[model samples]
Target chain A: MPKPLLALGCEGSANKLGLGVVSHDPTTNKTTILSNVRHTFNSPPGTGFLPKDTAKHHRTFFTRIAHEALSTAGISPSDLSCICYTRGPGMGAPLSSVAIAARTLSLLWDKPLVGVNHCVGHIEMGRVITGADNPVVLYVSGGNTQVIAYAEQRYRIFGETLDIAVGNCIDRFARTLGIPNDPFPGYNVEQLAKKGGSVLLDLPYAVKGMDCSFSGILAAADLLAAQMREQDRILSAEGGKLKEGEVRITPEDLCFTLQETVYAMLVEITERAMAHVGSKQVLVVGGVGCNERLQEMMGSMAKDRGGSVYSTDERFCIDNGIMIALAGLLAYETGFRTPLEDSTCTQRFRTDEVHIKWRDD
Target chain B: MTASTGSQDFPCVLTLDVPFPTARLASIALQSLQVDKELSALVRRTFSISSSIEGARGDSDKILKVEYKATTNRMLRVAFNSFMESLNLVVEVMEELDADVLSTPIAA
Candidate 1:
């Protein structure tokens, strides 16, 4: 029996820094995850993570996390085939910090380096975890929101957000509510949304053809939140009694309305992509992919089209090291190597910019 | 320590010399550290390999040298501090993955 190819992956493109090791069997076409460890840097409530602080956090914890990942995987440096790291489409400082670490590791271990695209990592990992083949991908997160599908060895972006991403809109709204950013802001908003059936408060639906806009909706949501606060102030001052012609609004209503509206826009774009590509499987991957409501909505839409939705839990859905390892390993198998001089990170890498050499369809 | 700068107007200058086991390691460090340009316009930085220092004896080159220059002490300090953090991380990875760590029972 031949020994499986092992690769070590490093990811610090955002608030989270993760190190993982995975092994792929050439004969069986199976990927076995040996160890996946992550450390997230969360800012205080009502505040989003700044690039400087987040980069500091990643540098502080990178060596320790890498140690744990290697020890947990119980592999020696000489056993690994290559070192993999995220190369772009993220915060610049954090991405550079991780890239530096990866370069050091590649040189130290005497292994080749493979720079993996961040979005391609999410898409490939989603496909592997959910066993969804040739699915229309809905990639949503803090920095990205795109409807992607593979065509002619490229994950083409059929539609995307014209303004702020859906997750960004939700996260900003969470800040307005002063909700905790740990775990994540989107989660707290989702929990709050569960309690709100009050009336699907009016919000601007910004879907335009296959693309959507979110800033207007976010502005509208912010105004509604201010009104809710004003309503609370008035009720508190008026002996806790409602006025004759005033309408009641709550934070829960705002959250529910935001999720419904933004998710509807996402589903519409995803369905359009599915129809355009003639694919039935819809795979949702990224930080926002962990939202059950979004998954449920996507599932319903897929079922209506005689298909289904595939998603993973927070473990694999959120950015982590295994995805990079998985994607890089695939690229490595196809004789791909990121030369040392060119192992740099950028902030504006597109998904379609990468050649999907590992996939033929 | 202060390193010579080509421009006299940039008075604040600092240099760091990090020794590695081999010249290849020193070259690797230089390559990794030189990729990201300084974030501030007021700061300028450069990296190179320095060999055969006075009292250094090794199988390969003596040091990987990094120099920073800025118009103000505050700018120099901010940029140097960030560079030191990344440098420390690279050194730590080298310490953990190479240099005798791989042969050690526990680290392996």
Candidate 2:
């Protein structure tokens, strides 16, 4: 039997170091993911963030996950054709950890090392899973949220949040509610939104053109909670027993309203971008891409445009290693291998900065 | 430090004096150095060229200031140095300015 081309992708931009393994299916001209693993970090001590410490997390997670993925795929180092890792647009600590480990593995295992852009990997992984060609991308995550389109050898940013990402805004809102971020609080908020019936709380909606202003929305949400708390105090002082849903914006209601507003903002901007690019298909990627609300909104927007919206499952939606590996494989094919001496790690690297000379064959 | 010669027209006062070629080289040199390794690590990524220029300071070659800021630390300083050295440009230690705060702007 012919040996399979084993490709591994590594991702550790923020809290998770994801590992993904794939076997290139020659007949289909597509790569199939075999196994994926994500290892989260232990929030660093002192400053609440440490580059070196996070890098350490990437290293540890990458090593363990890489081994497990290989084993799970029933392959060994010799079967591996290339090793790919997240290159940038991330925290330096985490990026370097993966880069250093990847380079080491490539050298030791004698495999070509491919450096993949973190953002592009997110986009491509979405494209791969959805099988969407030349689709407009709505990439929303903790670190970034932008409507993008590939053009003229680059992924141009069509529209974006002026300050902070959608996920970041949600996280901040969760914090105001004293919601724990552990075990994925965003998911919890989504679940809560499902349970609580709508209370119809009014809040500011600030969407300017194709861009978004999350600051105003964040402030509005925060103030709404504060006002609700004061109302509860007044109600209690007036010798009145406040019902569970009275004088309080149920977490579900808040989640429902917030998701509606955010997803609407995203859908409008993405539709504008699609029209700008004259594209019909839309591919939603990133952590927030996993949101059912966002997907549904995008689906409707696409329908209005006489197009379609495609999103990856949870595995590809969140940052994982397989996307990196796939991206790396393409980049390597196009001669994007960084020289060992030239290999370095960084926390920030914009998507536009990279010239897209590589593609999936 | 307060501006030595405050002029409303200028709003900010600065000085630049170098040989013609050296001034030009200085600006180019600075542009290349701004993305140096040490700074890239601090900022956390590689940076693209923002801007570069050359000016006159007598007959000798002088590169003027080049300004750039990397989004993340990617050892751009090292890459830049290697790029300049490959072109036979030897960078000298010049005054490194801070980026509107305690953080010193990394210039390779």
Candidate 3:
């Protein structure tokens, strides 16, 4: 029996810094996550995380989390096959910080390095955790929103956001309402949206072919929020509440409307991709994949097509090192290793750029 | 015949060795500062973090070294001023919002 392959993955594509260790058994073709650790850089409300700050967060937490992951996995550097780090499609500074850390670990441990694409990491992890084979994937997050499918050894992007990502839309809206950044702004928005009544406020739904745009909707929503705030201020100044019959929009309403409109657009594009690919299985991956509303909507769509929807909870869905480990392990099994000199990270690594040597289908 | 040295021949150079509590902070500062492109062709800048010897020894000690070169003292001072503004913002944000500073572990 061949010894199980172990890989250490470091991820800091955005505000989250994740470190995880995973092992794979070639005989059974099974992958096991030994340890997964993450640290998020949450900024104050109304302020997005700048690349510099996010990169700093990754650098500060990289070593501590890496140590914790290795210790928790009970594996020494000698036991690892490779060190995998997110190479791209993220903030340049954060990606570089993590990449440099990975390079340092490679030099320290005398191990080879594997640079993993952030999107592919999410998809591979989702497939491994949920056992979804060749499913149409909806990869949504703060930085990216895309509907992807596999074909000819490539994760073909069928639909994607033309402007701001879906998660970014939700986050900005949360800031407009001055929501707490603890946990996450999106989670807070999700909570508030639950309290909202079924009154769908009018917002732009921009879907062009298989692509969608969120900036226009974001602007429209911001305007609505501003108007709502002004109305509330005026009403409070008059020492009176909203009139009995006057139409009033609350923050909860704005959140609910935003989720509905944006998620509907996402669901539409995902469904289109599924239809185009003629695949019934839908896998939702990324930070926004943890949203129950999205899963529920995707589930309904897949169910209508006589199929099932697969999604992991926050642990696997939100950016984590385990995903990188899993994907890199697969690539490693296929004799893929990034040489030290070529281990440079990029900010715009596309999913298709990776040669899917591990998968035949 | 006489040899002459011009001001351009002796470029103004500035080096900053900023220390952080941890090598991670220093690396962050280095990476953040490295993003700013050279504003002037006459001015050149380079940044690097000191290797984490203390990290290898299980201690948090790091330093970021930045070097600037400009053809004239005025150009050097002007570029240095802009770099300082960005560097200050990065450090301030790191001090305020870094997970290590907040003592919050991000593992679930």
Local distance difference test scores for all models: 0.90, 0.67, 0.83
**TM-score-best of 1 and 3:** 1
Clashing pairs in 1: none
Q: Model 2 reaches what TM-score against the true structure?
A: 0.72
List per-model TM-scores for chain B: 0.80, 0.23, 0.73
Residues B22-51, candidate 2, lDDT per residue (tens digit)?
343344434433332553332222222222
- What is the clash count of model 3? 1
Candidate topping TM-score: 1
Interface RMSD of 2: 16.8
Better of 1 and 2 by DockQ: 1
Q: Fill in the DockQ of model 1.
A: 0.65
Candidate 3 docking class: incorrect
- Compute the DockQ of candidate 2: 0.02
Please identify model 2 stretches exceeding 4 Å from their true place. Answer: A1-4, A25-28, A42-53, A235-247, A359-361, B1-108
By the TM-score metric, which is better: model 2 or model 3? 3
Candidate 2 per-residue lDDT, tens place, A143-229, comes to 898899998778888888888889878877877777666555567667777776456567677678888978788788888877767
Tens-place lDDT per residue, model 1, A270-289, is 99999998999999999999
- Candidate 3 on A142-231: residue-level lDDT in tens? 989999999999999898889889999888888888888779888999999999956889999899999999999999999999889878
